[model samples]
Target: MVLGRQRRQIMKILIAIDSFKGSLSSKEAGEAIKSGILRVIPDAEVLISPLADGGEGTVETLVEALGGSLETVRVKGPLFQEAEAHYGILSDSQYSPKDEKLAVMEMSQASGITLVSPEERNPLKTGSYGVGEMILDAYHKGCRRFLIGIGGSATNDGGIGMLSALGFRFSKENGEEISPIGEGLKDLAGIENASVPEGLLQCSFQIACDVENPLYGENGASLIYGFQKGGNKELLSQMDLWMKHYSELVKEYNPAANPEAPGSGAAGGLGFAFRSFLQGELKSGVSLILEETKLSKKMQGADLVITGEGRLDEQSAMGKAPIGVAKLAKTQGIPVIAFAGTVTEGAKACNQAGIDAYFPILREITTLEDAMNKETAKQNLADTVEQAIRLYRLQHKKQ
Candidate 1:
């Protein structure tokens, strides 16, 4: 007589996907995958963790994942005009101590190139003062830990604009205060921090930076990025010279300054300023997000792991968010499957990078606009995931 098969244990699945960019958010993508999984296994356990690459959607992804709140403040814009910016505050017990709060922000929200119209975009006239104001606002709200994504800036000021707002004064040879714009860097002769807030000293900063350009030279901020910020050849040359002078001054003031360090030129030298003055640590954006989300811990006991983003290509295999998640899941011997809106031939690299298999969610040929429609993307993602999970169940049943 054939023995009765033993009952199977409930399947546990962990989903951590990045935003679809102009389509679905990270949270929404995870929910869609969860819906698909539930359809396949009614009693399966599913955990959703939203993630970002420390770029555009970082604040929203972190806020949702950590159960945090958002705070908005009006601050100086790239051109020193009043601009509204929003940041996330995390008080979750899992991520922070009861008395400690963490603030997550993107510099683009305040000093981004998008804030300045193309005709008005000029690195010489732009500043990062708004970024500093945002930090101060969060500090006053009891936040001492900062996770800042410094990308898409409009200034080439060597971060003096942000420093000025943070109570660090920059002066010319005559000791007159210098304007906190890129042009001001040309005449800068002195740096003073006597007025810096005491609380700021106790704060710690983690900067999300992926670029490796130094403070000045060919690959520096001004020479490489200034042109995109509306700088002409002549202006970028001048700005690069000013950046060199500013780095020298910073080195003199902070003996430990490393102007040539990787990422020191990120965000028009805001990376240098953060490293030199605020003691911020620059790190890989995707790696930082993975650590903060506690993805490793969450993967524990998970029978399978699912991760993906808007697109899967060679770049995704080269340390993008989805591959980051897959690598971590691999460390624990969990199988990882990924789903994307579109898949390119280069995406085959993802298989070697820890994604056991990947599937494109698009069902039929359609216009980009229709594919990206919110409702349409959601339905497509749910349907694709459901089929994948059904196949997953069939494989398990054979065992």
Candidate 2:
């Protein structure tokens, strides 16, 4: 494998890869890819740009990319248990006023499915109150603009839990206050928001969402995602009906709440909550992250852009971070290559999404458990990247 003159010419390469869940972080994966590129071309100029798609690593990715600090606070967990949650705050200098701080939050930190045990994965019992706590924590720290990634939720509460944390009240028909949870939605007869934190009204929110499911229906939150949160047939039906009822009640309080709005079903109705209560604007996660990372500026004179995720499959073609990066690079006529932990069926769809080529980072045949081992994944990622770059050079030399 040799590049010779080609290797010297192709000096600038950018790596903006997503985290490999349960394995490497976005920064770690980018470093591994960089190590591989360095192995093939020792002097190649490599830039490591960590990324995420509004999922687990979103807060960290944006913080790292924009040079921010993470603030951790004790917040209510999905099951109403105490848990430590993290939100990122970019320094004032990173924003326009140079004194205004920006907060980046991933809802998963406070109300994600991973917080619950398999045996206790009941959505009816989960609450997004913790997510609200996280936001308030950031607000107290002087963040007025929030970029929230709402994904991987465990609750089916239609934002009432979150609103509750912010001082909103849900009342029973008899004028009794009820704690907001999936099961409590049916008892909510009235909403009181006059007591909500004053700061909340001044803050702006932007939600990163990827789905377009409405608030309640066959494709909605309860029916489509409740089962994953431990809802059975009967429970799902009840949950769906409750969501419909809750959405209507919310509409009475806020006319802007349209349950038929796209992405209203995301994060179990947290998207609906943000959209209706906070007036948050929904945008694709990858597109938001790329703009935050300034990929357009980074791609200006790059010879190649490399990106990857935990897996490359049909899903990768559906607005995932790697494909989003590839499309951005393609617009500038920059070649984009991706490396994934494994290539599964339907990965060919990535070709149509603007990825010039992709490679699987597997050293040898191995079981799923072995392939996911931290050391094994790191080394394989490096080796596959090294070989792929060599092959790319080899192919280019012929042309």
Candidate 3:
């Protein structure tokens, strides 16, 4: 009797993992997993795509996945100091219309709270002038479509600093321009758009905002987020009152302004600025990223899809990056798996959210610092993926 050997089938796997913050980048994590998949199935086809939730890694992820370039400019920081800010310009035209360019930027690059030290984290003094500079820089580069992440801001100035940078002057009753910071809201009496660039009218902005705080009141920007940005009880109270005044002024300028709108209080009222002044649309970061990357179209012919983030918790089940990927995969009836550095009990919710299975990459007890080390994380992820694929292949063989 002669026995014949069965040939192994090639598997096409698609990966769209978010950056393992403080551990691995999206590209690096994908590559590590790909290495593991190839170890088990040498002939396997694997595609890695960078992913983010429109936060710290959004610009880098989009730039890498879309064949884009990064441009850095010297802009004013939260305290009106010089800071280097970078934005990404997408080279792929499919993401935008003809003769138009898309620029992805994180406001954190310019005026993030992290840019200022604990001692300098005064919401009353910080401003978002650098954010406006970044926009203007991208605009000059012929980018008419802007995707901005408005998280981690250090200012509560209602975006006056940004609007001022774009030539929307704010002045007092005496015709003198205000300081363009949180304190500026106190004396703001008029807004002038005479100096705004004509090209601004042709631009479109999409802001990534997840908060629902209104512009002013108990749940307003000042009262809700001001504490973290260095506001005391007295300062917060004063800032909230000023926010109300500023919102009224804004309503006078544009009657359609809705200070009570969801997300209007985001990024220290930056959401309101974008919506009321720039006519920008506020959207879910995950949804915007998925559409821009066209991940749904890319997953059509894929046999398996893998996604994950740095950590898996209740928040992960709340429509975070990994959940977003899994939900999209489910729409196509594809099997989805996820891996994370650590998995909480709440992560069990992910299984119901479309992830067929989830794995934690830690192979041994380790300190948090050691576990997050890049080299260690890469090796652990590779090992975890290899084992997962082995089990996957065994199940296939049984079928």
Candidate maximizing TM-score: 1
- List candidate 3 segments past 4 Å from native: 1-10, 397-399
Per-residue CA lDDT of candidate 1, range 117-227, in tens? Answer: 999999889999999999999999999999999999999888898889999999999999999999999999999999999889779899999999999999999999999
Q: Each model's TM-score? A: 0.96, 0.87, 0.93
Ranking by TM-score: 1, 3, 2
Model-by-model lDDT, in order? 0.93, 0.88, 0.92
RMSD values, in order shown? 2.7, 4.0, 3.5
Model 3 lDDT at residue 173:
98
Model 2, 1-399: lDDT tens digits are 366766557679999999899888898899999999999888888998768988778887777766799999999998999999999998646342447778899998999899999899998889999998999898888898888998889999988889899988999999998778888897989988888888787788879998899999999999999999999989999889989998989989998799999999998998898988888989998988887667789778888899989999998998899999999998999999999998887999999999988989888888989999988999999999999999877776787
lDDT of 3 at 142: 87
State the weakest 10-residue window (summed lDDT) of model 2: 91-100
| Model 1: how far residue 218 lies from native, Å | 0.8
Worst 10 residues of 1 by lDDT: 1-10
